[model samples]
Target: MKSPSRTILIGGTLSAALTAPVVAAAAPATMDVTITIPQLKVAEYHRPYVAIWVEKAGTPPKTVAVWYDDDMQKNEGTKWLRDVRQWWRASGRTMKFPANGISGATRAPGAQKISFSRAQLGATAAGEYTLVIEAAREVGGRELLRIPFSWPAKAGAGGRAAGKTELGAVTIAFR
Candidate 1:
């Protein structure tokens, strides 16, 4: 038993405590994303500059992530990033040319994985979202692909996708 003020305070504290867990549980989950680049013919030996990101149906796509075009010291990868088109305009165009994340080096032909979390992306950061991947090779053809999924940082929320020869196969595991 307690005074009215004490009872209200305790009751309010209890109410908040009970709902705190629910709020945390409602935060969706994290997403695991992977991308694979394929081997091209000898004539197409240039490792592509791949741009990966998330797109929301109603929202115009924004550049949330990027790979390659980070080796532009002497204008090396400066001209090539434009091949990815979408990423070029979204965030690559004005970038410092060569970023260290994945410059010069090209991904080998095979299945490769890249992981991103809610804490690692924006635009399609949460709620309904679609994953988009664009590959642009020096001599090969350019292609785009997408996977639709919700996100919040689930330990195993992921999906797999196969790219044209320019991209072998992509696997995403959110764990």
Candidate 2:
């Protein structure tokens, strides 16, 4: 009864692309992702606002995967990410409440699973893609976690790694 050693795979610089570059015809696929915010040394777990998205290498169009509820009035969970400037601007700052996918509810320090379909994903190729996770603590600062995951959006039901600063562990699956 021994546990496996988990490693953090950090690659890709999707965040660099804030403008979201347009790409060729992307293969229609679905990406089932799980976001986990590991325990932090700090108190007051105000439920961090997390943003997940995919981006094309050397480009501008970075597809938004999942952005926490940004509706301040309706969801205070979102306003917390102002520190996560990147996501704040890309998504949170929008304050429009995730249009379709999951509801805008603050998640505790645990696993939050969600799935995205091709219908939802505009256009992306199935060659090489990046999985970007941005976590913004309520009282804490922000941290960016990057993982270069090849797509169809679905290859192996594996995860990248958890960021020590903000996220604990992050997993993305095809099933």
**Highest lDDT: which candidate?**
1
Flag clash pairs in model 2. Answer: 20-60, 20-61, 20-62, 21-60, 21-61, 26-124, 38-168, 53-65
lDDT tens digits by residue: candidate 2, 1-175 = 0011011101111321233433212322445667777777665666676777666656543445445545567656444456667755654555455444433455677787666554333324555666678877676767888776665553447456777777877777653
- How would you encode candidate 1's per-residue C-alpha lDDT over 86-128 as one tens digit per residue? 7777656766644433233456666655544354445334577
Candidate that scores best on TM-score: 1
Off by over 4 Å in 2: 1-28, 62-81, 89-98, 153-155
Query: Where's the lowest-lDDT run of ten residues in candidate 2?
Result: 1-10
RMSD to the true structure for each prediction, in A, is 12.1, 11.4
TM-score of every candidate relative to the true structure: 0.68, 0.64
